[model samples]
Target: MAKITYIEHDGTRHEVEAENGLTVMEAAIRNMVPGIDADCGGACACATCHVYVDEAWLEKTGERASMEESMLDFASDVQDNSRLSCQIKVSDALDGLVVRLPEQQG
Candidate 1:
């Protein structure tokens, strides 16, 4: 399992053990991380699970897919590091990944 950290807009943090093959959105939902709404579940149909990947781990998470990139437009605060958590699959490579949530979901 990968150990991922989710930080809310107000600075609250939640650490969770995310199993490989599950999406980051699923990990957050399972761990009750406060900011990840995941309105479309893990189907990548919504941006409610939007997160800003920490710069240090950006390369490790890889670039967002075109579909994910398009979906990000519906998020509240778009940034170069912004990504849809549901599109990020959990893996050993992402064990120490850290992502920050925006102030609100769109």
Candidate 2:
């Protein structure tokens, strides 16, 4: 299982163990971790699961696709490192991955 650390705006952090092959959004929602709403499930349709990946771990995660990039257009307070959690698939390489939640999600 991959260890996902989710950091909140106030610095409070929640770490959860997630299985491989599951999307980050799915893990967050299933584990009841605060931050990701995943309102559109795992369809990559809604930007509710928007998050900013840790700079050190960005390259460790998979590349973003054109559809995910386009959906980010609806995200609020988007940053250069912003990514939709639903687009991130969990894997052994991402065992210790960390994703910071935005103050406001779309």
Candidate 3:
């Protein structure tokens, strides 16, 4: 399993153990991490699960898919590091992955 950290805009931190094969969005929702609405579940159809991948873990999380990029257009405060958590699949390589939530989801 990968250990993922979800930090709220206010700085609240939630660390969760995500099984390999689960999406980071699923891990956040399962752990009840506030700020990740995951409105469309893991379908990559919405921006409610928007997050800023920690620069240190960006490569490990991989690039956003075309669909994810389209969905991100609906999110606020987009950044170079912005990502749709639902698009990031967990894996041993993603252990200790950290993502920061925006002030509010789209």
Largest TM-score belongs to which candidate?
A: 3
Against the true structure, candidate 3 has what lDDT? 0.92
- Against the unseen true structure, what C-alpha lDDT does each candidate score? 0.91, 0.91, 0.92
Q: On TM-score, who's better, 1 or 3?
A: 3
Superposition TM-score, candidate 1 onto the true structure: 0.96
Give RMSD to native, each candidate: 0.7, 0.8, 0.6
lDDT of 1 by residue, 1-106 (tens): 9999999989988988999999999999998998889888878888999999999999988899999988998988799999999988899999999999999987
Best candidate per lDDT, number? 3
- Per-residue error for 47 in candidate 2, Å, reads 0.3
Give lDDT tens digits, candidate 2, residues 9-66: 7788989999999999999998898878888997989899999999999898868899
- By summed lDDT, the worst window of 10 consecutive residues in model 3 runs over 60-69
Clashes (N, CA, C under 3 Å) per candidate: 0, 0, 0
Of the candidates numbered 2 and 3, which has the greater TM-score value? 3
Q: Report the C-alpha lDDT of model 3 over 3-103, residue by residue, as the tens digit.
A: 99999999999999999999999999999999999888878888999999999998888887888889989999999999999889999999999999999
Colliding pairs, model 1: none
